[model samples]
Target: MDATLWKNSSFLKLWLAQLTANIGDQCYSFALLWYLLQATKSGTALSLLAIPEMAAGLMFYLTGGVLADRYSPRLLMAGTDAARIVVVISVGVMASFGVGQFGFFLAAQFLLGVFSSLFQPARTVALKSILPLELLGRANGILDTTFRSIRILAPMTIGLLAGSVPLSALFFANAASYLVSVFFVLTIRDSLKGKGGSTASKLTLGQYKRDIATGASELRHTRDLFYILLFGNLGYLVWLVTYNVGFPFLAERMDQGNGSTLAMLMGFYGIGNLLGSLYMARACYTRHLLVVLIGWMMQAAGFLLLTGGPAFHWLAFLGAALAGVGGPLIGIPSVTAIQVKATDANVGKVYAINMLMYTCCGMLSSCLGALWLGKLPVERLFLVSGLALVLLTVVGLAVEKRNHTTKHHSLDL
Candidate 1:
């Protein structure tokens, strides 16, 4: 871990932009989710809110990857940021004018999700370009810590204003954050530095198909990386879907559904994430496989704890904290592994594919979990989540052992 990460002005600028944008995203989400729960008190409604965004990701994620490989990431990022600012502010203004229809918000969310999906591949590739390969883990850890810390403060801010301020105000604040992010992105000088794989080639249909095929080939051959992407992110899906639906429903049942209470719940989770990521930044681990396995189990434990959280507020808090700690343990290493495995030419496509998988799983969880909300108890759902993680961890361990022995046997032969 290089202590001089701050010395790279370009990386710092990119990091700051991401931090600000993430903070704004948290604020916008906290405000909108709390508003929906207050208005409809339906788990289905909350899940429905995220559908458009996920749909957009599903539709455009691969295309975004293609664009990232073809053009300058800095320009792509800036364009998306500008579009996001316009769309977010428009939503805020429309809300202020009493156009408070849910459908209207849905349209806004769709646009936001589109720009967000487009931005991700560029952002991932840009970050890789800005830092050395040796420093990737620490860089990922530090960034994760900062991002989680922002989540803590963003929710806290929403809590503070829940009763006193209009929810629409947060939307405008989010637009302002996008404007700030744009400025920082424009300041970056090397968006094209990592353009070795495909420079100056026109993106024809044939070329696009070839690039997709190439990326798929790389993933198929890299078994370790492939397993991590497929199995490791299952935890992310379960955690995201269960918590997003369960927490609010549970909080509302306990009469703690107000913005402030929700803030406390999310804030504690953020604190746990921040602390865990900080530790990851300082510690060096030779066995990423072990780290990923432990992280999944830890998440399982946290979800099990959360099953009892509504009955015991302290238990829920503890559950949130545990889940937070598990976040960086799983996430940072997965990202670092992907970066390490991908070559310069294919990194954008690989990252896009990764995001595509993540969003697809998240969407399925949200939709299915929403439908199940009425039939299954939230506690039961959480219990199932815990069990699923346990199952995944065991499977991952078995797979690792099988692969390890096969390699050894091959060497002996």
Candidate 2:
């Protein structure tokens, strides 16, 4: 349980590939949302952007895991990256030509989501295949820290680039990053050979269904892991809506009333996220559920700080930083726990089930974000969600405390 994942060549290559692609993705998302903010002047539009993507992932994640188990993850990763290049480019072209239609973005998001649903489980399969059980936590921590660090800088770059460049250019950059990812992913040896692709062509629909069920069954049998993933992500679902939809609107109420201010505030959050992951990377987490609850507790405290009244920018920024610090606390441990607990034969499936739950929650959050933003002030939404999260975390803490005392299948790292 050491942070020595740097020595793993295959993981390094894949991490590099993901790193570049994530940078581009961060840029594209910022520009696209800013563009939509200007074009529609609606928080609903920004929130709606994720719904199609989540729905697509929800429908296909399990199947994608099945495919990953039966086929070559390298091929799946490379091919999906290549396909996303086309999909992202198309969105860029349409937007460049003055098509501000939300429906087009929705369609593009659906297509991109489909590609991602395939790529992600394959990525997990590749990661687990390459690394050992002990290194999984460190690997997750390093990866999360890097991704969060990107969140720190990418927005400022996007903010600087905002008036100077066309938003379509950001899209093009994302497409190119995917191309880069495809290159590195192609270079990774198909370690799942002899087991996976050897019989891929022979896989039938019945087997596909069975694979899905088997994954679900395995997840349920891994009781502690399954419940932890579920509750931890439920906390995140609220944060996703508040951050993505509420933050944009919150910026409008602030001093400059511009995207740059929002970018700066989010950058602070990224700074906090970076610090949290760095600590987790060096530490060993034996009780992942406790780690997740602690994250929720920090976030709850931050959210509760909102005077339950005015939307003060200073307070908002501080809360964002606190919430950011909590993210990796929740994310890294749960992912490592999943990887450590699941057998290799069904790891892809279990990971896909996790994604499926996340996507489903994401879809729900998208609707909630859009529906609620118009009905209530952004501050009120944050306050309420924060309160609910606090309640959930408290219940989880009580249950976990009882579970530990009872020794009800207590997981020891």
User: Each model's TM-score, in the order given?
Assistant: 0.86, 0.86
Model 2 is weakest, by summed lDDT over 10 consecutive residues, at 304-313
Q: State model 2's lDDT.
A: 0.80
Q: After superposition, how far is residue 125 of candidate 2 from its true place, in Å?
A: 1.5
Report how far off residue 355 is in candidate 2 (Å).
Answer: 2.1
Off-target runs (Cα >4 Å) in candidate 1 are: 30-46, 158-169, 191-199, 248-265, 307-313, 374-378, 404-413
User: Which pairs clash inside model 2?
Assistant: none
Q: How do the residues 1-413 of candidate 1 rate in per-residue lDDT, one tens digit apiece?
A: 56578888888898899998998888788877876676667777776787798889888888788787777888889999999999988877875665646787788899988998889888877888888777777888888888877776677677887678788898888999999999999898765465643466888999989988888888889887888787767776677777787777766645556666666777777778888899888767645666888888888888899888778878888887897788788888877777777877777788878888887777677777767777887788889889999999999989877876787899999
* CA-RMSD of model 1: 3.4
> What CA root-mean-square deviation does each model show from the true structure?
3.4, 3.5
Model 1 vs. true fold: TM: 0.86
